[model samples]
Target: MSPALASALAAELTRRADEDRELMRQAETIPPPDHRRRIAQCHRDNAEALATIVRRHGWPTAALVGAPASTAALMILLHAPDPGFRRDGRDLIAQAVAEGHCPAIHLAYITDHCAVDEGQPQLYGTRIDPKTLRPYPIRQPRDVDERRREVGLGPLQEQLEALGIRV
Candidate 1:
């Protein structure tokens, strides 16, 4: 990546992350139902901004700005309002992984998040149950640990435990 491109990506991603944090904090003061909607709207707006970057420069590869930037970009897109964009983000992440430009962890995140968004059971247990505020059950619960390992993620059960959740 050119210095100009790298500088731009770093600055823009930083701004988005900062704005997202601010909005999430603001949303916390809002009542439920509306609070999540407010937060989701913030994500949608951020994702739209990121979409502009994607349109201008294409997928923000890890080679361009390191894995964290790439991961953050994918994460915003996963929460995008447009299902097509969400699906496209997932596809782009997969291609990036295939080309060795992104980590497989990015793919796993988008996959599981998109599945939950589509009302299917997530494969990696990444989604939370909105009502219970707990990690949602995986489609194949028995093999979730193995699947998580395949993507270099630690055991899902332990992660949930750390979150004050069981199973």
Candidate 2:
């Protein structure tokens, strides 16, 4: 990928992150009904934007624009209301990882999320409740720590602590 394209994508990713973060902050405040609406709209628009970019450029692998930009794209799509869009992004990211272009961690994260989204066992136990700050129950609880370790994720205790959830 050209430097210009990489820069452009990185910039756009940064902008999306800022907007999303601001929306989240607003959502945390009292009387955030308007912010809730704004967040939904923002998510829809961001999803469409990523879809368009991916359709044109395939998955933006780390080799294309650095890992930051690629991961940013992955994160935005993960929260998308449409499961199909998230799965599409996951497939592209997985292919890139297999081709040695992107990091395997991205696939690991997506795999867990997609698994939970599909009501199956999540390998990595990454998904958490927004309101309760607790991770969704993993399918095969006994094997979770092993799976997470394989994916470069830290201990579940550390992960939950980092998310501000005790236990």
Candidate 3:
């Protein structure tokens, strides 16, 4: 990634973090139904912003990291341009959630290990496991396995290992 792109990504992540914090703060005072609705809207806006950023950057491979469980799902719903993209993304997210990987930790692994442009962490391949229905870290194979273990993927690990992923 070029210096300019890296700087842009850093700025974007910082902005997103800030927005997430603000959303959480707002959620604290809202009623349950309203809070859920507001949170959903916040997620939609964030995903839309992310989609725009990715599109502006030419649709680089993006990994949705974090434990919200809904992050990846929402991302897919909001950003994927077609039904196929949405289906694929949703399947992967389901696998990840089933395998007990949180979005943030999974995101860290992808960002740290993948060949992402320094400025654009959101433009990366979406790696999802078919059986576990979870997103795997594209960058750190070892960490992915470790995470699988931490999440108690005994049977699932066997299946993935058979596929040569070692998780």
- Candidate 1 stretches with Cα past 4 Å from truth are 30-41
TM-score of each: 0.87, 0.90, 0.37
Clashing pairs in 1: none
| Best model per TM-score | 2
Clashes of 1: 0
lDDT of each: 0.80, 0.81, 0.46
Candidate 3 lDDT, tens digit per residue, 44-133?
A: 675666556545542223333222323433433433234443444445444555455434334432432232223232222244446665
Stretches of candidate 3 off by over 4 Å are: 58-147, 150-167
Q: Which digits, one per residue and each the tens of the lDDT, describe model 1 over residues 12-67?
A: 87677766777677765778898787778778788888888888877888888766
Query: Candidate 2 on 1-167: residue-level lDDT in tens?
Result: 67998899888976886788788887767366787788888899888888888888888788887778887887787768898888888898888988999887798888878887898777777888687777776867888888778768888888888877896
> Better model by TM-score, 1 or 3?
1
Error of 2 at 50 (Å): 0.4
Residue 87, model 2, lDDT? 85
